[model samples]
Target: MSQPRATAIGFTAVLLWALLALFTVGSAPVPPLQLNAMCFALGGTLGLIWAVATGQLSALRKVPLPAFALGTIGLFGYHALYFAALRNAPPAQAGLIAYLWPLLIVLFSGLLPGESLRPGHLFGGLAGFAGAALIIVGGGTGFAPEHLTGYALALACALTWSGYSVLSRRFGTVPTVAVALFCVVTALFSSLLHLMLEETVAPQGLLGWAAVLGLGLGPVGLAFYTWDIGVKRGDIQMLGVASYAAPLFSTLILVLVGIAEPTLRLALATVLITGGAGLAARASLRRKPTVAVSASSDG
Candidate 1:
């Protein structure tokens, strides 16, 4: 696939991700496990229907069990930590911490075959981290001791997502099939967790139900499939740069929705993150020529 097309797909996925916190915050009454279970269950059902229609359901049986297991755990684990992070701390702060996965992806991309860690990537990542620090410190909450658990969970969320993306790339699989399996696994695990650990909390109104449906159809389902394809076939460096957009978009959306107020700290964070991502992606300017494959229909 050409870089531009793949990057577009990745961008769509990130755009959906920007709405995640807004929906999650709106569903504050719902437990993470229950939310995860409901969203993934809906997503998995959608994916299954798509797969069957596309004749990909048969391919699922051919995928190795280990790959299924890894994909499932990765999908479930990241959200589990992320949902906990949102519940434990202010959504904006916790969101920034979890967004660190992009930088981690850039750094860890070096572990994959033929990929190298470049100086621009490292420098940009540091700048982004500095920006994140500004947001955390100046974000009104000011590092309260009570929110430490949220911070920790957010960090784990970053690690889990980074690891998942890198590992998914390292192990090639059919994107649709893998995503379907992972969603199913996540739904099961989250259901179990909900049953064992959470009290029942149902969506109360139109907005609440909308949040659940949007999350199910977008972030938890289609977004993951697109992301898998992007990371596997798209320019990894470019995706790294594009990913910072997620947090920027997320924060802006929250502000628009009145969940958060615009602040100088956020403005600076946007500049820093955007600048850093541009610098990091600058290395992609030197890519060697490759055959352009049409990826638009692949999904």
Candidate 2:
């Protein structure tokens, strides 16, 4: 596919992810691990069905074991931390902090062989962290001790996802079909963890079940497949900048649904985070020709 087309396809994942926080909140009362198990199971089953129907089952066989392992760890670790974060902290705050992955992706991409870190990238990182600090410190009221663990987990969630996305570039030859196996393994792992650690509380009512299904079908399911294609083949830097939109849309969803209130602090933090990502993106774009050459060569 053309680069622009792939990038556009990849951006769809961002749009889908905008609903992640909302669906996650709606799926609540169900423990994190259990929620992870349920959503990934549905996602995995659907992915496998698509693969079979498209006659791509043989393509999956070509994917290396290490790739499978990496994909599983990324998917499982990210959602587990995210689900737990929202449960422990206020959803809007925690979700914003976790959304730092896009900025992190921009920063981390500088470590790629042909990409050079610029002053703007460093400054952007600081700005993004400042925003996160605002969230954690509760707009200068000092640490919200009760939510520290959740904030910390959200930070870790950002790191895990950014690392996964950057590293996935190295496996550019791997077909997106392999994401099905990743989802399957993640489901199994989540199920095991839920069984061992979490009490089984089923989703409460129609809204709850709808949330789980929404997650599986949209954010958790097809998002991964399209993202795999985008990051592996499309404009990664562009996607990184575009990702800031997810948090904005996510928080808006929460507010509209009455799940969270729109506050000055949230708005300010969103500005900081989005501004930081834009700075980093500008640096990346300045060297776009070189980066594109390197990406093509690497792929």
The candidate that wins on lDDT is 2
Per-model TM-score versus the true fold = 0.87, 0.82
* Candidate 1 weakest lDDT stretch, 10 residues: 289-298
Q: What tens digits encode model 2's per-residue C-alpha lDDT throughout 1-299?
A: 66666778888998898898789888989988888888888888888998888887787788898788789879998988887888888766786678788778877877776556777776776676666555545544333679999989999999999999888888877878889899999999999989999899989899999999999999989899889888877767667766766666676787898977888977887988788777866875676454342232211
- Give me the runs in candidate 1 sitting further than 4 Å from their true place: 84-96, 133-137, 140-153, 288-297
Q: What is the lDDT of residue 118 in candidate 2?
A: 76
Clashes of 1: 0
60 in model 1: Cα distance from truth in Å? 1.1
Go through the candidates in order and give each one's C-alpha lDDT: 0.78, 0.79
lDDT of 1 by residue, 110-188 (tens): 7877676777777777777667656544635655779999999999999998888877765654454568878988999
- What is candidate 2's local distance difference test score? 0.79
